[model samples]
Target: MESYDFIVVGGGSAGCVVASRLTEDPDVSVCLLEAGGTDSSPLIHTPVGAVAMMPTKINNWGFETVPQPGLNGRNGYQPRGKTLGGSSSINAMMYARGHRYDYDLWESLGNKGWSYNECLPYFKKAENNEVHHNQFHGQGGPLNVADLRSPSDLLERYLQACESIGVPRNHDVNGAEQVGAMPTQVTQLNGERCSAAKAYLTPSLTRPNLTVITRATTHKVLFEDKKAVGVEYGLKGQRFQIKCTKEVILSAGAFGSPQLLMLSGIGAKENLDVHGIPQIHDLPGVGENLQDHIDLVHSYRSSSKRDTFGVSMQMVVEMSKAVPQWITRRSGKMSSNFAEGIGFLCSESDVQVPDLEFVFVVAVVDDHARKIHASHGFSSHVTLLRPKSIGTVKLNSADPYDAPRIDPAFFSHPEDMEIMIKGWKKQRQMLESNAFDDVRGETFYPVDETDDKAIEQDIRNRADTQYHPVGTCKMGTPDDKFAVVDSDLKVYGMSGLRVVDASIMPTLVGGNTNAPTIMIAEKVVDSIKQQYALLKQTKTASCEPS
Candidate 1:
């Protein structure tokens, strides 16, 4: 029967930060519980090792979407992190803050204090930009953000092609503008991945006020009347309960958090009744409004002999020689974030914001692994951003171990498919451009682009998720029935309970989500501190003069 000032569940991206920040005060005690184990794998630390962890359950939740009619009823694989750092530990490491308009939309929807200008400081506070120290970037923060250590020649040509196509080169996408070709900044520190667990939890583990317990699966939130007082969880086949004197924060990510909420009788009433659980709060938005990015890869067999695929032996020798150089000097191919080059563009000229994101990889990625062909190979992955389609996440049964029902309904909007088709055409034209004339070879996908309908069908058949799932429990004003949390991230109708993960996003950000999730955590920490301080002052005033 242990009790604490605060109990944070799911020690992933947001939970780690909440627990660490809450424990900063000497009088407050905090406990963080995580179902996953430590983030100690070599694959998690190495920048290039993400390729190996994609299809495996080693550090992933390996869930799949229900049959998506837009993709001809084919199920799509959805991978999430199941380790200490969560998905941030196993992601591509791109550091994108999304467009300013994204946050303005939240404020427009009655969520105050969420404008781009207000949220920008949180993004800066969570990052330790290695390159510059300006109003937009912090110098000595915990999370490391830096330029690509290894720049490939093919990527340089790709950037040139973008320039030739009227798109300007942006030195920093996270700066004033985000509508150009640029080398993506990554969350890495001296070539190692800098996950949230690494940045926040690792250093705070030794704090006397903080206690971190891994391998603890939270079953449900304990409520008396309507107030969340504690949690019920299990560890090593033993069930346990812990009371919370202050609050219970859920950071189990987009899927897990919603699933837990539903199991605790806090979701749609119909869903709860069907699952034989008593309805405590009928919040229908707990698992609705799911959104994600769908990507299509166009591979090309290279004509040049200098591609990374053909330089395997040379690469090994280079790595062997560069190891010591890195040990002493810290530079070279070993420091690269694999996704060397990227471009942002709109599908139509009339569109104001960029709708498509292109990632250039030096090696070929067949299924999920980075498979090197006998000849040199390169790939261009076109991702549709800001999709109009939405989906849901539901529990299969009431089992916590069972994977939830994830239906992204990708390409549900006809316009979304049209955009991908246009992206495919744009990719072909870029390949045929003079910038790649010396290195171009045969196209690997949609082998025949002459037929428009065939190209569209091919894209639908081969499309893959970029593994960015968000917006299940959105944040908005009380008028929106589906809105689970308010602008301050407090769960609607529930005291001492809050959500601080990607689940709080009203809409998916325009680009990578890892950095944005971290930014949300940073912002929510300040809100929590302000609220706690106000409570402390009120208590002191009440006791002083009566």
Candidate 2:
């Protein structure tokens, strides 16, 4: 059994950052296991390649939820990345840190050193923003954040539409406040996708101290007397065990992290009994508190396909030319991230902050874009930034290969439906603005556009995830029964084990989760280094003096 100072499971967004930063200190050797293949596909690099990968299992987990009764008995599709970069390699690459109050809420929940003020440094430390150099933005960092290289004219139109509906333009969504519309800043470098793997892992690949194993699926974390010591995993049908001399960090994302803990017999006794897995530690919150941004999309057919992407014969010819244009110059349609324009607004006038987030896409997206249409169109995604309903991730079976049962419980809360209805109503005002008069053709759903009941029924029939799922293994104070990990991200009642991913969020952030997930990894890496530094100092002093 080979050993390392640290073993990080899941080479997704957070895992990449942890492995890269830990290996920066040559003394600390680290091993990173990725369940998927390497992020070497052209589909993982080109910005527009995201659309092609969404419908296929290529580098995507493509998990489906248990039928949600809230969505009129529909099974929502959940696509996660199965590559070294993880979802970052397959996502829209929108770089958003949520709102300042989002982190402040973490501190208010007794998670010390996690307030926006404390977390800001880590966000800056991980970012290399190409534009907006201010106190909030950073330069000379690993993760590159920049404006879109090929922004669509529809983006301007979307902003104009928002303005027509009394929404102001926000120059910088990540700075000062997140209250208005703007062209989304993306995680890209030179018009290419700057996934966490590209930003963090690619540069650290040559480091001998960092051992990155792709196509390796971790079955369970091995523990000795409730202390994590190693992990049992499979690679090419061969089961193997690797020792962790110091710590076992689970960065397998929200879903994978909690599922791994349960597999390791560290969940509720009742849950383990059903699966016949012996309980090591009973933590009831292993897979509880699942939260996601439930989104309602409005798709509209367009009269012209000049700037919008479509699936017609004309676009086939356009894309044939576009493919080479992007390969050679790294510019044009291929560089567009699709969901280019963003807006933040309040569902109710009395709300303190914006609760509704609007994502404007340059093409029609049906069922997370899995359903393709031959017509030219655009879509506006209205996501409830924070939902009151909670969900769970339970074991489908004892087999590690089986996908976990995901129940987001979207709209289970009456208030969630209420807010969503209001948000959908507000979103329609923007969709019908005069700015889109020249391009807009036909509204796809909600035949009775003015009726509130029709709009509510339409939302219940079509509402789904915006792909931001979090808070399964939540971070909280020790006394909190639902807490999976403490403020420092250390698993409660367990030593040598930590969770450094979106799962650690006590509550979901208000925007895209990718950037905040990277920041969590950065912050946790700092904690890991500081802990050992203090230990080293104590050991040195004990040897030198009394």
Candidate 3:
């Protein structure tokens, strides 16, 4: 068996960061295991390539949710990144840090060190903002953040429509306030997607201390007397074991982390019994507390195809010319992240912070773009920033290769539906503004634009995920029964193991999760380093003058 100081399972966003940061100390050796292949594909580097990958399975673990009663018994798509950067490599590169209130809420819920103030340094440390030089942003960081190389005029019109209806223009949503409309700040450099792999792992690839094994799927976390010591994985149809002397970090995202826990017999006793696996530690909260953003899209066909993307002949010819432009200069249509403009709003006047968000797409994205439209169009995604409904990620079977059963019981809570209904009506008002009068055509899925029941039914029929899934292995105080990990990201009742990904978020943030997930990795690395430092000092003192 190959041995290393640390082994990080899952080469996604968090795993890449952990591996890169740990190997900075030359003596530390880390082996990163990724189920998917590399992120060197041009499809992953191009911002617009998300359109092709979101609905398909290229470098994506295209998992589907169990039939959601909340969605009238319809199964939802759950696409996660399978490669080095994880979902960050496949997602629309919107660089949102979420509302400051989100982290403060995490601290309020008994997680002492996760307050916005405490986490801000990590967020800044991970970012290298090309434009904003404010106190909230940082420069010379590994991850690059910049405005879109080429934004659509209709996106400006969408912002205008929001302003026309009283929304302010927030130049920097990642700055002080998040309540307004603005062009999305993306994780890009020179108009290319800067996935976590590109930002962190790519730079550290040559370091002899760090080993990244792609196409390596972790089957279980090997343990001895309830302490994690190594990992069992499969590569090229061959099983292998790698020992870890220090720690085992699980960063396989929200779904994969909980699934791996159960596979390792560290979950509920009943769950282990059902799977016919012997139990090690019974952590019932391993797969509970699943949360995700449920989004309702409102799309309309565009009268003119000048600025929109579609399958029409006009767009085909335009793309022909546009491809060469992007190839030579890395600009034009191919550079767009599609979901370009964003708006944050409150459902009611009494609400303290914005509870709803809008993502303006320059294409007709129906069914997460699975059902392609034949003509040019535009859409706006109305997403609930905070959802009240709870969900779970459970094992489908004992087999490690089988996909985990994902049930994001969306809209199970009456309050979630109530808020979505209100948001549905509000988006219509925003999109109906005169700013889009020249381009807007018929709605993609028409409802009685004013009737509450029609809008409610419409929301039920079409609402789905905005691609942010978190809180499966949530962080909380030891007293909290539902807490899976502690403030230091250590798995409760277990040693030499930690979860450093979106799965550790106690609650869903108010915006896109990619940036926040990267921030989580950044913050957890400090704790990991400090813990080892204290151990080293204790060991030294114990040996001296005793």
How much is the lDDT of residue 50 in candidate 2?
98
Cα lDDT over the full model 1: 0.84
Return the lDDT, model 3, position 513. 96
Off by over 4 Å in 3: 541-546
Inter-residue clash pairs, candidate 1:
none
Candidate 1 matches the true fold with a TM-score of 0.96
Counting clashing residue pairs in each candidate, in order, gives 0, 0, 0
Residue 316 alpha-carbon offset, candidate 1, angstroms? 4.6
Q: Can you write out model 1's per-residue Cα lDDT over 179-294, one digit (the tens) per residue?
A: 88888788888877888999988999899999888889999999998899999998999999999898989999999989999988999988788888888998999999999998
Taken over the whole model, the C-alpha lDDT of each candidate is 0.84, 0.92, 0.92
Write down the lDDT that model 3 would get: 0.92
Q: Model 1, which residues run further than 4 Å from truth? A: 303-330, 370-375
Which residues of candidate 2, in runs, are more than 4 Å off? none
